[model samples]
Target chain A: MDLFIAIFTGTIIAATPLIFAALGELVVEKSGVLNLGIEGMMLVGAAVGVWVSYAGLPMPLAIMSAAAAGALASLLFGVLALTFLTNQYAAGLSLAIFGTGVSAFIGKGFGSAPLDALIPLEIPFLTEIPVIGPLFFNYDPLVYFSFIMFGLISWFLYKTKAGLVVRTIGESPESSHAIGYPVIKIRYLAVMFGGAMAGLGGAYLSLAYTPLWVENMTAGKGWISLALVVFAAWRPARVLFGAWLFGSMTIFQLQGQALGISLPSEVLSSLPYIATIVVLVIISRNWQFLALNFPTSLAKPFRPAE
Target chain B: MRFQIERRVEPSSFMRFAAPVYATFSTLVVGSIMFALLGHNPADTLFAFFITPLMTINGISEWLLKASPLILIGCGLAIGFRANVWNIGAEGQLVIGAVCASGVGLFYPDPESALLLPLMVIAGMAGGMAWAAIPAFLRARMNTNEILVTLMMTYIATLLLSLLVHGPWRDPDGYNYPQTALLPDAALFELFDPMYRLNTSIFITIVAVFAMWFFTERSFFGYKMSVGGAAPLAARYAGFKQSGSIWMGLLISGGVAGIAGMAEAAGPLGQLSAQISPGYGFAAIIVAFIGRLHAVGIVLGGLLLSLLYLGGEAVQLSLGLPSALTSIFQGMLLFFLLASDFLIFYRFTPFPKPIKSGVT
Candidate 1:
């Protein structure tokens, strides 16, 4: 029972960053842009978040600075994909390379420094419960924020007028433009939002989860978040489930070792990536399911006709 | 006033050549500003980046040594890129290739046999192809996105390589180092010059360039693949199979990249280590684009990019600049090149007669 509660707690903590990033990407994709640079953006966020935190700023301010840095990095992609009309695939890739390089350069001196980790919240009423309290009520603020974000994103995507506009643009940018919606502006906003969320995810790693800075520290969590967005079929509610599934896979190695499973640590470490590929294959194998869920204008550059 | 972009009826051939040059010039200008901000002499930094790397004969040899794998991999990537098949997992393929080639070199019964080198090359190519075949099959059968699949496979490959080096392939005499034993003399490539690292592996790259040129420029199959890329519907109408292009494109690139991996293992490395490459596979993607997905262009692009790698090291030694600056410059060059590519299909002009704007 103790092990079960511990695993559940670890899973939720692990899933927080993915939740933030995948939700952001879901919104960006809903607005018809495929930003493959999430990994890069998260990396920049992690580095900047750690740098600021090491400078003795408040934790919230450090996280916010990370988000701003991510947004600024993503604007570089916006200029290329939205304004200059470069190939989004290539543009996103270059943005990722740019982010990795810039983050490494800026974070060189800060890599060895550690930041104060975010403390787990202790709700007064919930603290009396045994297993449930430890599993649910004892996580850091980011975990709660991630849960709230899922509900908010679901509401914004399906219930709001602005959400409808974003989805309509994703389905057919030309029609959206013809109906007088500012497609480019909306997409730019979505891209920036996605960037901010990816940044927040990065901050969660350095300021909350690991509490230390390392080169390329996000370590492909950004890519897993991308896979999570797909696994969820671009739905916010499903994203929560998918993020938990992947996050559990990440922690399973540690849990397995505790349970006396004797596999090599490297093989165990590879489980999440292998699981991602397998899930991707299973999801993509059904052509109709994929066709129905995938955004029609995803990865297509929208250049309004004059 | 303001500038408006206008579509060109036909792409300007002059701009086709001029865009890369313009991007190079702008990157230099931007790079100088970056260096000045870093408290270094801009001119000296730029010189170190571009010219200082090739000042000595040994330097030129080292440049070519690094460029060989990049050119080999870039040529393969160029073929796939031309057909719009994104196989960004060349890094994984390269790693697998090295693993297989080293497996042969380390365990082969007759290490001194003349056939050892050829066998290693074949095994390496086969290993790379086997790794790439996963994504090819997935994309062809399941309609999966190749970009994500390939990238995911790279992470898996890195882990697999680490597992092998740390466990089964660890050197016995050496104290817990994560690497294989040194390959035998017969497994190594012959040196072109004893004074430098230049080896016979470059001859393979030269031959590959010629083959790539002929295939892409003159072959009917290449023409079909290009049609498949440019107009998918038209290609379907013309009876060109999409699966054919995907398979051939991936296989060719995988095979070439595998051979390059074998060259690195048998040439300068002489053994398999956990870090056989410093992201040569990813850098090759930049080389493919800078060369405009053309065979001859890849040769030049490979040289230029290889020079950048060497120059980055030189600057680190001389100016005390962070080595990460190389990647920054490389990324900036690609960004500028992509931005300038707009000139291929559109021209910027002064906004004519502020007219009402609406969807046409």
Candidate 2:
């Protein structure tokens, strides 16, 4: 029972970054823009977040600054992909490269200075409950933020009027423009929002999860969150489910070791990546379903009919 | 005076040629400012970064030595890029290739036989193709997105390399380092001056460039793939097999990248390790794009990008700057290139705000 709780807690913590990033991207994709620079933005966020924390700022300020840095990075993507109208994929790739270099540069000195791990939020009355409290109530602030974020995103995406406009724009920017909606402006906002979330996800890494600065520390979590958005079929609720699912896969390495599995550690380390390919294959196998759920105008260059 | 971005009826051929030039100059100018920000004299840093590395004959040799893999991989990636097939897993393919080539070089019974080098080359290309073929088969047969799959595979390949080097392939005599045993004499490429790192494997790169030129500029299959890229609907309507293009696109790029890995192992590296590629696969994407997916352009881009690698080291040595500066420059170059590409399709024309309602 104790082992089960540990695994459960570990999975939620592991999944926090993915949930933040995927939920952010879900919104961006729903608005007819694909910012492939999520990885880049996340790195920028992670680097900036840790730097702020290391410089003796409060953790909340560090986290906010990380989100801002991510949003700024996304704005760079917005200028290239949204305004300059470069090929989104290539532009995003360039951003990834830039973010990686910039982060390494930023992280040059912080490698040796590990920050304290984020303290899990504990509500006094809620702490008395048994398994339920441990599973649902005990986690770092970001994990709980992810839960609130998941609910809020679901509410915003499905139950709001502004959400309909974003969805409409994703479906067809031409028609949305015809209906007098400001397509480019809304998309810029969506892209920036996604960037902020990705940044928070990065902060989760440097401040909450691992609590240290490493070059490209986000690793492929940024990319996996991308896959998660797809796996969730751009649904907000499913982003949480998919995050937990991948989180479990990440935890599998540790569990396997504890259970005396003799697999090489490298092989164990590779499970999440291999699982990504398998999940991508599974979700993408039904071509029509992807076509049906995928954001209609995703990755397509849209310049307002001028 | 106000200017309006007007779409060009025909893409400016002049800008098609000029955009990269413009981007290069832009990167240099921005790079100078960056140097100044870091408290170094901009002019001296630029000189050290760009020119000093190429002044010496040995430095020039190292430049070419670094460029060979890039030019080779860029040529391969350019084909796939032209065909709109994104195969960014060239890094993994390169690693797998080095692993295969080194496997042969390490385990062959007659390690000093001339046959060993040739067999290693073949093994390298085969390994790259095999790694790439996974995505090719998935994308072609199962309709998967190659980008995510390929990127995921890159991580797997890195882990696989780490596994090999750390476990079974650890050098017996070497003290606890994760690397294989070095190859014997006959398995290695012959160096040009014996003092320089430039080796015989450059011939393979030269052949690859010409072969790529021939395939891309003078072949039916190449034309078919371009159609697939430029207008997929038209390609399908014309009955060109999209699956065939997918297979051909991945195989050629993967095969060439593998050869690059083979050359690296045989030439200077002479062993497979965790760091077989220093982001050559990713850097080559920038090379291919900057080269405009053209044969001659890729060669120039490779040289230029190699200079960036050399310059990064040069600055690190002279100014004590961090090595990550090279990546910043590479990223900025691509960003500048993409921004300048706006000129190709649009032009800023003077806007006098003429009324359109009544006249029409």
Candidate 2: stretches off by over 4 Å? B353-360
| Weakest 10 consecutive residues of candidate 2 chain B by summed lDDT | B269-278
State the TM-score of the second chain for every model. 0.96, 0.98
lDDT of 2 by residue, B1-360 (tens): 999999999999999889999999999999999999989999999999999999999999999999999999999999988888899889989988898998999999998788999999999999999999999999999888888888888899889999999999999887889988888888899999988999999999999999999999999999999999999999999999989888888888888888899888888988877788779999999999999999999999999999999999999998899989999999999999999999999999999687888796
Cα DockQ of the candidate 2 complex: 0.91
Docking class of 1: high
Candidate 2 falls in which docking quality class?
high
User: What are the fnat scores of the candidates, in the order listed?
Assistant: 0.75, 0.88
lDDT of residue A213 for candidate 2: 85
Query: Among all windows of ten consecutive residues in candidate 1 chain B, which has the lowest summed lDDT?
Result: B351-360
Which prediction has the highest lDDT against the true structure?
A: 2
| lDDT for each residue of candidate 2 in A192-252, tens digit (9 for 90 to 100) | 9999999999999988888888888887999999899888888888788889989998887
Tell me the spans in candidate 1 whose CA falls farther than 4 Å from its real position.
Answer: B353-360
- Considering summed lDDT, which 10 consecutive residues are worst modelled in model 2 chain A? A109-118
User: How many pairs collide in each candidate, listed in order?
Assistant: 0, 0
Report the error of model 1 at residue A114, Å. Answer: 2.7
